[model samples]
Target: MKDIFTNLYNKVIGFFQAEKGDSSKVIASNRLKLVLMHDRTNLDTLTMQKMREQLIKVISRYIEIDQEALDLNLEGEGDAIALMLNIPVIRARTLEEIEAIEKAEEEELAQKAAKDAEEQEDAEGSSDESEETEKNTKDSDESGNAEESVISEEEANTEENLQNEETNETEKQKVKKK
Candidate 1:
């Protein structure tokens, strides 16, 4: 009785000691439960039952299987998730079936890898293009600034020449007056 009381006391302490900042498994399980309810029943549990029955029927056509042992599990894999179809088939399988399954999985993985490579290449290409464009823009801006400086210098020289001409004209007018 004392041991049971001590154990209960420890459990209560553990519950209180749990970090409040992190979400607990109970919270995640509750969220998943809400999501999975829709998957399990489309407002009609009978329809979902029919679907499971039909799925087993389709799979059994190709292989000798134990329907009772079959499991359809859905779980998270990182941010993504997967639907696992586990059908218990007889140990006796044709070379063709094994080969077919292997070929399909390989093809799927290869396609995913190719898509990833293509996306990576596209991202790199866009980054390189953007960097080149930025450099070109900066170079063009610098060239434009240099041209403006040249134009200002020319304007200043023209103004100085006009001032000299005015001075000469004034000197001539004074001589004429004299």
Candidate 2:
């Protein structure tokens, strides 16, 4: 039946296919150990110190690290050398935390802008009120000056009438004496 043919097909495929495991990792580790052993045997202490400094500088760009407690070593045994590195991070912020910080900054900026706008409006309003007060004072002063001029003219007319009456009385007395 169909089941028997399927089983035979699977068996034939399994017989020809190779097994899969950590063979690539094993090969990489062996090659790394051999290369490190050969290179570290001839590398001077100054060169290793330089390498450690460079590594620290490169790794510090992405995280807050404790450089004073960092460790870098090249351990060798027989013909095998292992390069090891350990770096301690102070804190790792997730995407949400970073976004929260950015949001807080934006809110602070918006609040400051609103406060500045309010202050500016108050200042302009006060300036406008002062201008209106000055205009009102000028109008009152002009009306007071007009009233004073009219009162002075009336006093001058009254003085002229009193002089004319005095002259007429003197003429009548002269006519009676004649």
TM-score of each predicted structure versus truth: 0.31, 0.29
For model 1, how big is the CA root-mean-square deviation? 37.6
Q: How many clashes show up in model 1?
A: 0
Number of colliding residue pairs in model 2: 0
Give residue 62's lDDT in candidate 2 (0 to 100).
49
| Global lDDT scores for all candidate models | 0.67, 0.69
What would you estimate as the lDDT of candidate 2?
0.69
The alpha-carbon lDDT assigned to residue 8 of candidate 1 equals: 100
Residue pairs in collision within model 1: none
Please write out the lDDT profile of model 2 over residues 86-119, one tens digit for every residue: 7778976567766666677689899999998986
Q: lDDT by residue for model 1 over 34-146, one digit each (tens)?
A: 47755654434334345556887667545767665565545555555565677767764477876676677789899999998986777687867766776899999978866
Worst 10 residues of 2 by lDDT: 14-23
> In candidate 1, how many Å is residue 126 off?
72
